[model samples]
Target: MWKIAVGFALFAGLALYILSKGGDIDMSGEKHGADATHSEAPATAVSAPAAAPAAPAASEAK
Candidate 1:
């Protein structure tokens, strides 16, 4: 029936969306580790150490 087909299509779409957003992809491996470590070296030197902005001192407020 058309209703059954529609229901099945809806179910399939929902399942695919759920799985895609769930981070099911596995990227952990030796190559990934090597790439990360290799890329991090120069980045550390190029990027400044990030610091939180100083908050307004309490006494400064009225």
Candidate 2:
């Protein structure tokens, strides 16, 4: 029990120290509605390779 308390204190202190060094830390937890951010990248249109010409029939070739 004592060990768990000590470990939690150390972790929390370290987390707070790091967060303090970094400005404007949002500790408000998860956001909702319009406050949420959309991390999805914009879609891109890729042009597919052109199809090869149709092969000639065996009878027509002969």
- The sequence of per-residue lDDT tens digits that candidate 2 reaches over residues 1-62 is 99999999999999989999998667789999998875769899999999999999898996
TM-score of 1: 0.39
Clashing pairs in 2: none
Worst 10 residues of 2 by lDDT: 34-43
How many collisions between residues are there in candidate 2? 0
- Most accurate candidate by TM-score: 2
Off by over 4 Å in 2: 29-62
Quote the RMSD, in angstroms, for model 1: 9.1
> Looking at candidate 1, what is the lDDT of residue 54?
96
Candidate of highest lDDT:
2
lDDT of 1: 0.76
